[model samples]
Target: MEFFVEQNSVVRKIWGKSDTVLFIFAGASAEFALNKAVDWLYFTGKLPSDPLGRLFSTVSYARKIVFSSKDDANKAIDTMRKIHATVEENRGAVIPDWAYRDVLFMLIHYSIASYELLEKKLSDAEKEEVYNVFYRVGRRMGLKDLPISYTEWLPVRETHLQENLQKSHYTSDLFKQYKKHLGPIRFKVLIESQKLVVPSIVKKLLYFGVFSLLTPVIPMYKISRLIKLDWVLKSILLPSDYKAQINELDVHSD
Candidate 1:
């Protein structure tokens, strides 16, 4: 009955709530677009073609790993590796190890960022715990040169931000696809949400302004969550088609 993430773990608190998970992807969507290796994502045609579906699919695997037993979580990780291996086989080139690390780093970064944005600040120990979970995932996936601790990871994460991201044609096209899929209103929300969680480098690279529109709205949104009226707001802010999937993001609450 041992879970991949312990029952009382902060990782569960971060990923269990729908709002935090949404913001995690909202931030990740920006970084994913700006990644130097984004063409690898485009190779499958899935990310650009149905970005929201891709988000949910990725979230599904993440939650499976976070919530299941250790054996099941390891199996899910193996499946993900095999899927990428097949993509590499088809494309006839290996995806760079750094690209894999970038993704793992994104999960670690955004998990802390999104949760702190929605809830209170995490202590140093809690932040280290977050890093440890994903560090294990990275090791399982055979990524090399990952920083051994969250403190060590900070500079490495910064280095990756500097060396591994650029505004390519893929960046613009992916943002366009996001806007197309989310529409004007939701896309604006997504951008603002990304502002609240993404790193300074991401903000600078994307030319985001100093302020987010959501800065003032977050307190009000927190109030709405306390009263159980958050879904009403979510309905208005999110597309109707994904409403069910969005609701399902609140796994630990049940």
Candidate 2:
């Protein structure tokens, strides 16, 4: 059975680990708040009301594609497209093509960024491989004007960063929702983690300081992982209600 991502792929290594996946969303949550089309997310009312549940729902679809057979992955992608189409129908406005591309680009960017921050830097070929997997998913969803190669995508991603993001009222409200949901301490950790993975533009727009408090603690966290005590730390840091789902994020092994 051919998998959507090959068994030996670095993409699996990146997404398989719980810490890496958490960081991916940490960066994405910041960018999601800052996106120009964030109102589209607010339209459904699901995102702001239950942001952590939304994170798990999004991660479920992503893992389904990454770990399943090709046919299953395609079905998951089609289901996502249908879900968005239903949302568009209910809202009576077409979501912009660029909005869709911005999301796809976020997955591609954060996948590499999160892994490198927690693990080692990905080589050029490995980064291309990462881009290709998500590119196929975008093609399945009919996203347009995506760059064909990872090298070509860099400038386009930068352009999207510049043209497609702003700090709107939606941004402020979403961050408030995050803080409300995660509480003060976890919220502070989320902000510091986002600082580690997000781009310079995101840092500028979010007014994040250059230094992350988590910087010195990463080595200690890595040691915890090696000693098999990482889950204990994760449980303490994350909310109690999602403990089971957080454990499930470690579904795949390298």
Candidate 3:
């Protein structure tokens, strides 16, 4: 069977790990708080009700597209588009064009950022491959004004960071929800993890958050990995029930 994405692609290596997916959502959680369209999420009540569940649902769809045959991947993408359309119909208005682009951009940025953080930095070619996979998804979703290439996307990503985000009431409320759902400790870990992945601009804006407190742990994590004890150390940090689910995120190609 022909795959939609290559068996050994960077996209596969990145998304195949449950840890990377969590990090991706971790970075997204920071931005989602600041997004102007966030109230739309409040409309569904799903995010406030169960933020992790909503995030995992998105991760599952991403995995389905990455691991499936070409025909199945396309079908999965179509289902996502129809889901959005039905939401628009229910709301009696279209989702903003920029709002759509923001979600696409977040996926693009996090895919590259999360992988590099968990593994090693990607070469320019590998980064471009990451962009192209999600760029194809964005085009299929009919998103507008996406940059034509990864090189072009850099400044566009920066522009979106400047133009599309800000602190709002929604931001505070969402973080409170995250704290409520994750409890205070894991929520602190989430903030620290986002520090490692989010753009410098976001870090600047988050100047007084948990990142500083967690910086010392970085070298310790590296040392743990070198000694082959990182998995045990990191697993202790996560909720017990999620440990196996994370283990299952390893690469499995069609």
How many steric clashes between backbone atoms does each model show?
0, 0, 0
lDDT of 3: 0.81
Clashing pairs in 1: none
Clashing residue pairs found in predicted model 3: none
Query: Candidate 3 — which residues are off by over 4 angstroms?
Result: 207-211, 222-228, 240-244, 251-254
Best by lDDT: 2
**How high is each candidate's TM-score?**
0.98, 0.98, 0.90
lDDT of each: 0.92, 0.93, 0.81
Residue 41 accuracy (lDDT) in model 3: 77
Per-residue lDDT tens digits for candidate 1, residues 74-151, read 999999999999999999999999999998998999999999999999999999999999998989988999889999
Of 2 and 3, which scores higher on lDDT?
2
Model 3 steric clash total: 0
Give per-residue CA lDDT, model 3, range 1-254, as digits (tens).
99888988989988876667878988988888788888877777888887777776777788888888988988998999898788889898888988888888888899998888768899999999988988888887888888989999999988889988888888888889888877788888888888888887777665635445556876687677669786886576776656666666754622
| Lowest-sum lDDT 10-residue window in model 2 | 245-254
lDDT of 1 at 93: 99
Where's the lowest-lDDT run of ten residues in candidate 3? 205-214
